[model samples]
Target: MDSFVYSVNATVPIFLVMILGGVIKKLNIIDDNFVNKANKYVFIVALPAMLFKDIAQSNVKKDFDISFVLFCMIVTTICFVAIWLLSELFMKDDTMKGSFIQGSFRSSAAILGLAFVQNMYSNTGMAPLMIVAAVPLYNIYSVIVLTFKAKKRNEDGSLIEVSNAENIKKACINIIKNPIIIAIFFGLWFSVLNIKFPVIIDKTITSVASTATPIALIVIGAGFEGRKAIKKIKPTIIGSVIKLILQAGIFLPIAIWMGFRNQELVSILIMLASPSTVSCYIMAKSMNNDEVLASSIIVLTTLFSSVTLTVWIFVLRMGGFI
Candidate 1:
């Protein structure tokens, strides 16, 4: 019961905010153009700022658990590789391959994951460490998958697929220039060097970080397309299942068996079940993948994660794992 209420308190407000965005859009309080610009702003400025602030502020050195971090890295890599290979073998639509793979494995570690932990525990606990371990790999793997599966239109309007070697090279370049990745790097450096910011600069970062999640959620709600989601329903459902269920089902038990509990276990649960990140849609659009599919996955996962995550938390609490 406590777990259920905790889950509701953590997820319901976010769900309501998204619903508010959808309501505003339906009433024509905002239009698609505004949503489009909002997404751009989130991808370019808001998300980066939020990540920088979180990583920079985290006491990573004090809380650094090499074993936990290594486990996260291993699981994230396996998921990314396994999903991409599965998509290659099974997904018929080339256009959806990248988005499908991305939406499947990328967890919302930075935003909703942290929010869930903070709400439930009144502190971030190990969530920031979890982000440090997994989020960079998420961005790196996303770049590779999106780049390799990218297709462009020829003069005659036929699609041209990128070669593997060129895709790898381009992905390497993108990993360097990606704003989120760059921000993560700088944040890690600051944490490592124990850099302190001036009060005004810190306040500026805090203000910018504050805008990241809400604006992204609103934009996601405004741009959501139900009909398009239906068109891509198969992959969308598969990806959601992977994100909200299978990953957790597979990994959470291992975490428990390995003796992680309390805050560490709860953080692992968030890493597994907190829905697909909005960044998936952003990167899919930028990389010329199926943005509709990406957006649909985000919407569906966000809507469903409330229940799924609640169940996980309840089960974990019952079993004395958290």
Candidate 2:
């Protein structure tokens, strides 16, 4: 009973905030322009600030577990490679192959993951470490699949083919330039060096950090397009199942066998099961992949994950895993 209540308390408010954002959008209180700008703010400023603050303030050197980090990296690599290979062999729609694979494997690790951990634990806990381990690979894998599978078109309606070598180079640049990864880098640096900011600067960072999760959730809600999503329902449901259920179902048991519990288990759960990040849609559209399908997967996964995540948390709690 306690576990169920805790699970509800932890997840319901987050989704409620998203629902509020949707309602606000319906009322035209927040427009696409607002959602776009707020998304940018969350991505480049608020989210980074939050991560920096959490990691920089934590006793990272003491808590750092190389084995745990390796497990995260290995699992991420396996899932990405496996999904992409399967998609290549099986998916009939070439345009959808990239979006399906990307949407299936890439999670909302930084945004929804951190929010859940913080809500339950009152701190970021193991999430920063998980982010450092898995997020770079997520972005790199996304770039590779999206680039190689992308169907580029000229303004005059001609196809443009990109070389594998060019795709590899672009993936490298994107991984290096990713803002969240950069923030994690600096956060680790600050923690290792025991760096301290001035009081005013620290407080300002705290304020900005505080806005990251809520605003990001709101932006996700406001940006959602239900009508666009319905067109891609078949692929959307498949991708969502892979994201919010199958990944966790397959890996959580393995993680248990490997002896992860509590904060570590929760972090792993979030990594494997959270909704497809909003960035998936942005990346698909930018790379000229199937943005419609990407949007559909995001919408479906985000909507379903509310209930699915709660169930996972309840089970985990009942089993004393978290």
Which RMSD values do the candidates have, in order? 1.7, 2.9
TM-score for every candidate vs. truth?
Answer: 0.94, 0.85
Candidate 1 lDDT, 62-162, residue by residue in tens: 88999999988898998899998888899889889999999999998998767677877888878888998999999999998888877788999898866
Q: Give the TM-score of candidate 1.
A: 0.94
Q: Candidate 1 clash total? A: 0
- Looking at model 2, the pairs that clash are none
lDDT of 2 by residue, 81-197 (tens): 988887778778888999999999998887667667887888888987888788778878888788788887899988888788987887678767767668878988998888999
Candidate 2 TM-score to native: 0.85
Itemize residue pairs with steric clashes in candidate 1: none
